[model samples]
Every structure is written in C-alpha cells, then in structure tokens.
Target: GAGVSQSPRYKVAKRGQDVALRCDPISGHVSLFWYQQALGQGPEFLTYFQNEAQLDKSGLPSDRFFAERPEGSVSTLKIQRTQQEDSAVYLCASSLDGPLREQFFGPGTRLTVL
Candidate 1:
C-alpha cells in the first residue's frame, strides 16, 4: 500500500565499517531494484529482484556489495569495509507488474564514509 521506503536517510560510517541499508517496497509489487547514485552522476543499477529471487546482480561494484530480497517485499543492501569511494546515495525502487519499465524510487540513503 505504501511506496518504497529506505532507512537512515543519512548515514556516516568510518572507513572499514560495514553498513546495511534497508528498503521496503510497495506491497504486492513484483519487481524491486537497488541503485547507487554518485554526486553529479546518473544512478547505476546495483541489483534487481522479482519476488524472493534475485534475478540479476551484475552491477554490484564488488564482492563486498550484497543484496537480498528474502521475502520478496523487503530488501537489504549490505556493504562491507566501507571506503571513502563508497560514499553515495543508495536508492530503492519498486515496480508493478507491467510490460513497461517504470519504478517508484525511495528518498535514498546517503552514506558518507570518513
């Protein structure tokens, strides 16, 4: 019934700290997506899940980045060994069952590593 929502709208993590970002997609949505947006750049797809299965995760920058949609409605993106370069906005989006590619995005979780 609600749109996608992400926790910790802003986060500050020291270098090497691990972080977990959460997302709650709209109920009944068939598709969920996670994106990373760097300053002054377009968002990059990190992963995509349909239902409880992760259909694609080719965009994850490294092995440290992991995503899961265990129950198909809530998703989490975990980043291990946070680095300064990992600072960016993590955005979550969800889409309904349709032929067109359309997704509603969350406000984004801004992570800043010091």
Candidate 2:
C-alpha cells in the first residue's frame, strides 16, 4: 500500500463483545505499532512489532487487548470482552525501522464500547 490503511473507521461494540480491527501498513516497512487514543488525549503506544516479531506490548491496558503482525505487514488488534473504558481510537503506524525514524499513521479505527 502507499500508506497505512485501517478498516472500519468507526466501530460500535456492546460491552463484553469482541472486536477485531485491521491494519495494512506501507509496503516493505519493518516497524509497526498500535496505539490507543482516548478522546481529548494523545495517542499512547500499545505494542510494537519489528517485522513479524512482537518486541513490545507494554502499553496494552489489560489482558483483553491483543495484537499481532503475522506476516510482517498486515496486523490486527483484537479486544475481548470490551468495556466502556475501551472506547477510544485505535491507531496503527508503520515506519522503516523504529521510533528513531519517522512513521506514517493510519486514520485509525474508532471503537465505542457501550
């Protein structure tokens, strides 16, 4: 892809339901990241992948939040048993390497848990 792309710009999920958000990063990028952004707040890193290896997942709010980059390009973030607190914009970004380099971000998947 020419730029990062995320599916379902907005999602509405009832509490306790599971949802999966997709992301297609720029072609041949080596670093991918998932971030959670609450309304009126800055994005916070949720996880990072260097190629197919998940090197960091320190910022995931809880066990219900899971992310994966199986083929080093496309990735998915799944939230299980969603809670009201989970309502936020889930953003995905890709870079040539890591934070040391500039990254391009997708518009994001806004998840609203009710």
Candidate 3:
C-alpha cells in the first residue's frame, strides 16, 4: 500500500526554461489528477486521466504545460518556457475510481521561477 509521492519537493528555474515534475501514485490505483496551487490560492484542476487515457486537460494554463499518465499509473507534468507567474505548487492525487472516492495527495512539487 504505497502512497503517492512527488520528487524535488522544490524546483527553481529561470524564466523560459522547461521543467519536468514527477508523481508516483499508489499501487493499483486507476485514476489520477494534477492540480496547480498558487500562493494563498486553492488548487486548480489541471488535468485528469483514467489509466493511460487522458480524460481532461482543460485546466492546463497554456501550451506551455503538459502532462501524461503512461501505463495508467505514474504521471509527469512538464512546463515549457517557464515564467514567473508559473511558480506554484504542483500537486498530484490519485483515487480508486469515482468522485466519491478519497484522493490521496503528495506533499507536492513547489516550483519557483526567477
């Protein structure tokens, strides 16, 4: 019963650079989601995937952001051409299968752009 995990815990990048963040969800889970949380703001849904199929990605701010859940488990979020406004905590969560199910979240990957 492994829990969700994120790497780097923190990332500092120069504006216009590309950054990739990783998330490892619990074993056997079928649903995953990525969210962005700005300082003093609520986490906003960025994308969702059921297994390797991406269900939604309308929340991604722009083409600069991309995500994928290959093999229906581990996921990665990549932000290209980073900007100061892009600095925030990127969170990943996983659930068993429905909206009613509880989603477990990792500590998050805090990104800082300079």
TM-score of every prediction relative to native: 0.95, 0.97, 0.96
Q: Pick the candidate with the highest lDDT.
A: 2
- Cα lDDT tens digits for candidate 2, 1-114: 478999989999999999999999999899999999998999999999999999999999999999999999899999999999999999999999887799899999999998
Q: Model 1 compared with the native: what TM-score?
A: 0.95
lDDT per residue for candidate 1 within 1-108, as digits (tens), equals 667899989999999999999999888888999999999999999999989889889999999999998988899999999999999999999999531568899999
Better of 2 and 3 by lDDT: 2
Candidate 2: pairs in clash: none
Tell me how far the alpha carbon of residue 78 in candidate 2 is from the true structure, in angstroms, after superposition.
Answer: 0.5
How many collisions per candidate?
0, 0, 1
Ten-residue region with minimum lDDT total, candidate 2: 1-10
TM-score of 3: 0.96
User: Where does model 1 exceed 4 Å of error?
Assistant: 98-100
* Stretches of candidate 2 exceeding 4 Å from the true structure: none
Model 1 steric clash pairs: none
Model 3, 3-46: lDDT tens digits are: 89999899999999999999998888888989999989999999
